[model samples]
Target: MTIEIGWKLDNSYVNNLPELFFTKVNPTPVSSPKMVILNYPLIRYLGLNVQTLQSNEGVAIFAGNKIPEGAMPLAQAYAGHQFGHFTMLGDGRAVLIGEQITPLGERYDIQLKGSGRTPYSRGGDGRAALGPMLREYIISEAMHNFGIPTTRSLAVVTTGESIARETRLPGAILARVASSHLRVGTFQYAAKWGTVEDIRILSDYTIKRHFSYIEDDENPYLSLLKEVIKRQAALIAKWQLIGFIHGVMNTDNMTISGETIDYGPCAFMDTYDPATVFSSIDIHGRYAYGNQPNIAAWNLARFAETLLPLLDENQERGVKLAQDAISDFGKLYHRNWLTGMRAKLGIFNEESEDGSLVEDLLNIMQKYRADYTNTFVALTFEKLEDSSLFSTDEFLKWHRRWKDRLSRQQESNNSSQQLMKNSNPSIIPRNHRVEEALEAAVKQGDYSVLERLLDALSNPYDYSIKQADYSTPPEPSDRPYRTFCGT
Candidate 1:
């Protein structure tokens, strides 16, 4: 009989690394813990024995109160370039409890963010504040519902005690699910400090776990690099189409699995501005919306540098191969970005002058300072008669161009309109609404607003019957929201 209560980690990946990189360590103890949100769908999707994972015993295991049988808990090691400067960071306040082979025959890493301190904790308390923890839970779940590839949140547990951040705040931990925690920086950590053998081992293991199909290729290293670039470009284009600003798109924060991993200071834009940035630390707007494509290419270059030693026997030949592989990221990113923008504008066929059609709509939106989400949503609904709905009169001129473009495409039919409505989301996690919901939950323990927000967000593409308030942009009084690092 298959056991339901205990879990075993078939840790084949650990064999590739030195023991010192992941010394089995216990989490720092915390005060009272209370369960907040549990992701039932994910628990089932992972094909975890539901009886044990959802039981009180399972809740205890998830909250870090109990480590199940055969669980090899260890923190992952990695170095990252934070903002513009390189720094070594690891699972400072997070821990990989174990790895599970899901029922679908896929493998996933089970990790706990804010679990407690580890060897990588850089002289500060390794606990997460309530705000950031909840922010991740909200945004990650919202992204999943929006059909974007992202790490899923399993459960949220609040520590009774408080941690000091901008203020004394309550602490919480999030059980996060991912295809794998191996990142570009994971290889960087080894290349910069560990031996060449370590980089070779990591490359082999990464291929086995993520790109096993490329193993037989004579040039496996170059093929792996190209695959990572392709996936990241597609992922970033999805982010741009949805108006997500990752706030911190550091090298270490990126996952090789192409999932949107970290959600720190991340926000969806309100106004349709290309230069929008909300992360408090982003003083120079280096990771702004318009600059994400360039930043992604830059990060891929760094990853390319780390993999150079393993790419060829001769150092110079390897460097040349890596540069050539990284050069393809731009072409792939533009192709994916344009394809997505075409869908958003209801264009089905590729035309030589499609760029002008797309660019003109964006220019109009910028000139009008329109609400990004609502503008696209309004066009999907195609209620051009209602002019007052737009924040500016510039939408009127754009409406004509949008209609002219739609007329050229086959999707102008009634059936096409219906399909676009399903493709385009009417509601998203508006920044102001998210802040309002989270504040209410934290301050008063009133989850009604959070519940309502989730209800609206669940059917993002569908029109809500009585939820007009949730769809509208926040008033002038709720203009700015300051996001903090969950230190």
Candidate 2:
């Protein structure tokens, strides 16, 4: 198929920022770069020419060796609350090359992360180590396969030079695509500058880009805040249903578009544990698995605070309106979450106690310490009959409750079976598998393992043809593996 693309950079968003933030650009350089992986299918999805993107010259263009003709690289300036404390942070090691408005009128950023440093590079090397790059490529693609909204990896290029962290590791660059790179922290930065005019401008611009339905609203800023809160709550709740731990739920990492960004310290649960945290820097366990929803609501509160000036004319009125909007996050999250859980359990009708139904199942999972993926897989594998398919008594009890609820479900047995099949994935990027793939590539220079894992993750819903071993967690010997931030 012929892939077509058209791009227009919307410099209008950050047009009025300080010149130093935009004009002073210095990207660190790397040597003898090699193109390790290219997302050809995604390139076609974006309607770009694969022949050009795959060429040697295209490799240079992708690796930040040379910028594309119409592309403009600029680092965004934003502030974020890291571990509950606000800090000034921006794209320190990343640069937004430009934006592309697709044929469908969807705007996406063609960003070069690990390209080099900008003014935001806060006293650290602006390069990325190979391991993290590969991990993101694997996990991000896995997320997409699982039908999650995320930043897509366009390409991964190895910079021949070595980067020093705990060990000397090869450098790499990732070409990431996103709907928009604007974050809740972006609004926080402008709000902290204490410029109401800038806040209005930012709020108006965001409304146009994301929540255009509010363009004609009387209180557009308040409407935008409400819409963002709804989106974030739904996003976080989805993460919970899938057993995903974002690992770092800092305000800066939370994007306003509601797409999950920064796969630095992220993992799927092997066992049903609410407090699972894998990031080494997250010593306080603030962004644990169970805390993601609460963190999301907290970040939305910060976003609401930023828009207080434009939310209403009266300061008191604005505070009240923003609070009202932020408060709806819980209701919206619970509503969306229960909807998703119903699909998982194949319960189409709404129950007044749906949240309790969902919680009861989770309590059982916790009590049994059941494998999250396996439980769902078994349910989808067979109907509620013969609960013995699952190995645990705790699951059997939950299965009984599930069967009772299933008797009242509106969906036919066949329909429910099909819905369950679609809702629950058979495989996710297992943490140990990802680490093993990366280690093999880095230590033995074997890319086959990485390739195989990517192939499995590319279609997580299809377990029919998959090897039986990929669906299970790693053995006990492979337990306790932790991922590090490759700065």
Candidate 3:
């Protein structure tokens, strides 16, 4: 049967860019594709026909067994610094079907992850394991619910074939939707390899697509750099405010749209530890929770390097301009992070002491090893049940100071609490719970656990009895959790 849901797909990226930016490709056909899960809410949001998309033919399209009309599958080319080591990389196993135009007239890139190998596949089979694909589906949706800018997962479909990883694993594909797949690395690729004019073309296209308002600026490329820096600073602040660790802060993973992408080894911090590292491959702890801000500044510096030619006519003047802009990253990130911290602490007005106040709370959390999410929740809801940590003299002193600070605000306690409620999520995708769900679905082929977990995570800010079940931290006796890149 032909799958026809009237997709409004267009190859805008390929149509606008030269062949150097991307290469045309198709997804490798899978054997016996089956739909594991479909994001009906997201489908409806995109104004797609949900009923038609639930059919078997739709599963084939998702699994790379069939290509739909108006879909021009291709693989994007880019380069990145992985763990500070420069390398030429691109869409090894992913295939961009086309940009989907929603009923509301918004454009989003609809890509197939783990679809197949392309020119960028570095001597490895371009197949994805079912567990990791579903993991991305679960965590990405959870991030979206938490009000973070993130790529949305449309569906996950299983391939009736095994792939060789640590052992034989079930194969799957993830249909990912994003504002655009352009990354900092894309600029890096154009800068290091292509001519100066190439960077100009890519920058102009990016500005028109994302930073359209800046097109009228005298130096639009410089404004583009500043805007990207601002967005990234704000985006990283949101991640840190919610205790999210991106695990791998590679240049390739940082989106030009400032949306969180590449959920390979990303995990939420359970305990308030600055030195948290979950990615097994991150042996040096470079992308730890505390190092995220600094790493973001570093990545932005790399991005700034790619735009030096367009920043100014004189090379020397361009370098100075880039340096000055990069220098502001610290101030930008601190302001954004401090603002978020103020909201989390229920502080309506900012003061000089606010930064130290937030720092003191974090120090107490670190000193007592308090749960990151729950500690904020306790303060937000006045749930002082955790006497083991909250009853200490140090914490009590901090709590009294916090209360005094709140009293000074003109807003009523009710208003402050509401702000805190909006800023701090009561629930995060906890590591142990995520692992349990993946274990059940991957090992036992039971998806009820995953579905229930998703339901609990659907409303992270609103506290409920069902959500409370998954809010508990892992037992102390449990082994330390580690995550893989799933390559």
Candidate 4:
């Protein structure tokens, strides 16, 4: 495949046998196409020619003003359960332009989120505000550096036009790359609106593409469910350890690939509160910090529901099998959570008291309103060397017990400190910092702050002195934190 053609002949999604999976659509031509940022690392990673990508033609293609040669643009059709209510939803503002197969032979979905109207626009203008696109770009890249599975930004382009949400804001498009655009809700859509044969076809295609090891299994659909459950268990556990709040855990946002997707209104916790909710829409705390593991299990159960017909020939047996899969979610999540928590606390060996040790530390953290990222990062430093950190009567009490537990293990202090350092990140995309970046871009049309914050976050583990201020939590003046979906 030549770089001028942009992609190889294999558009598996298009060549595949289903017209119901997507609807053919063309991206509406924009007024002026301008490049804002191109992810050089990801471009090279995907093995695309950088010289071609930065050319004027590349700018037009990315901005959705011109379709690339041999590209098949379409809007994907999928249903989602929004906020516990099942509603038919599709790509209201986004379009999947094509799937790019890397020189390494791995395929990823190349999507234009905030690219204009599709068949699924549903009475809303198909456009994106600059802030949310920028938010997704920052957080998703940060998540990747944090060693988390995530959909990443390949490029961001300006439409040189204005979009109105609450008011007139600059329009932008995020060229997002993902393992695939398939989601649990994709299966939900198939099961609800498509034939049983369609569901089976989706299951087989999913297995062949992502889980070929399970292709020969006696019950591939059931096996797929089990594997998804396992990945989600591990992923959610990582989120808990790192204090990430996805904000919206709706069905469509949950990917079947188990990678974190749809970074709308998501925030990392500053204070260690189980009930922390930053999304302005999460009024009842349904997707709160402490509830992620359980919510993941719930989402998987819905996924299993979509696979019922393919799970087994007999309905009762299928229900039982799915129930067992759902139960495994709890077991798997607990084990992964415990294993991750142990690493954060520098516990190499499992112990009966380990759970309580972890629990007590959290209790003390909540009591002290401790900054989540800083508290764990502090453990790696000299004991109490940073006296300004989470220091209190309750924290000291927990610290004595924690030290006693560590003493039982034969690992050297240096190794334990190394484990702490590796497991805990010194910085995350703090909410206040993110807000500052967005404010600069949306209001003053300044992107330098966004670039600077992205720089600090790109090396989250190193904690370089120049980026020290990025690690701090929000002050009281920034209280009552709120994030919008930017729809």
Give each model a TM-score.
0.94, 0.94, 0.98, 0.97
Regions of model 1 farther than 4 Å from truth: 5-8, 49-55, 385-397, 477-479
Query: Model 4 over residues 1-487: C-alpha lDDT tens digits?
Result: 2456356525677677388888988788889878878888898888777788888888888888877766788888889888899987888888888888888889888899999988888888999988899999999999999999999999888899999888898999999999888898889999888999999998888888889999999888999999999989989988998999999999999988889999998999998999999899999999999888888988999999999999989999999999998999888888988998898888899899899889988887787777888888888784565534446777777788888988989999888888888888888999989999989988997989999999888878786885788987788764598888988
Winner on TM-score between 3 and 4 is 3
Model 3 residue pairs with clashes: none
Ordered list by lDDT, greatest first: 3, 4, 1, 2
For model 2, residues 1-487, the per-residue Cα lDDT tens digits are 1122333455544464444234335355667778888898887777677787777766776778876556667888889998899998888889887776655667788888888877788987788988898888998888888777788899999988887888798889999999888898888988886478777777777788888888999878778887788778878877888889888888888888889899998888988889888888888889888888888888888888898878778999999998888889988998887898888878888778777878887877777666788778778766444333365666667678778888886678888877887888888888888888999988888889999989877777777666456877777664465667677
Give the candidate number with the greatest TM-score.
Answer: 3
Leading candidate by lDDT? 3
Off by over 4 Å in 3: 1-4
lDDT of 1 by residue, 1-487 (tens): 1267435456655656786356576666566777777777787787667666666666667667777666678888899999978988888988887788776578888888888888998987878877677789889988998788899888888878788876898888888989888887887898898988888888888888899999999989888898899899998888988889998889998888889988888999888889998888888999899899899999999999888888898999999998888888888888887888878877777887778777877877777667887877777776644435454556666667667777887665675567567666787788888889889878887778887887787778768774577778877664465565666
What lDDT score goes with residue 26 in model 2? Answer: 37
State the lDDT at 197 in candidate 2. Answer: 77
* Per-candidate total of colliding backbone pairs: 0, 1, 0, 0
Off by over 4 Å in 2: 1-26, 383-394, 477-479
Q: Which residue pairs in candidate 4 have backbone atoms (N, alpha carbon, C) closer than 3 angstroms, thus clashing? A: none
Better of 1 and 4 by TM-score: 4
- Each model's lDDT comes to 0.80, 0.80, 0.92, 0.87
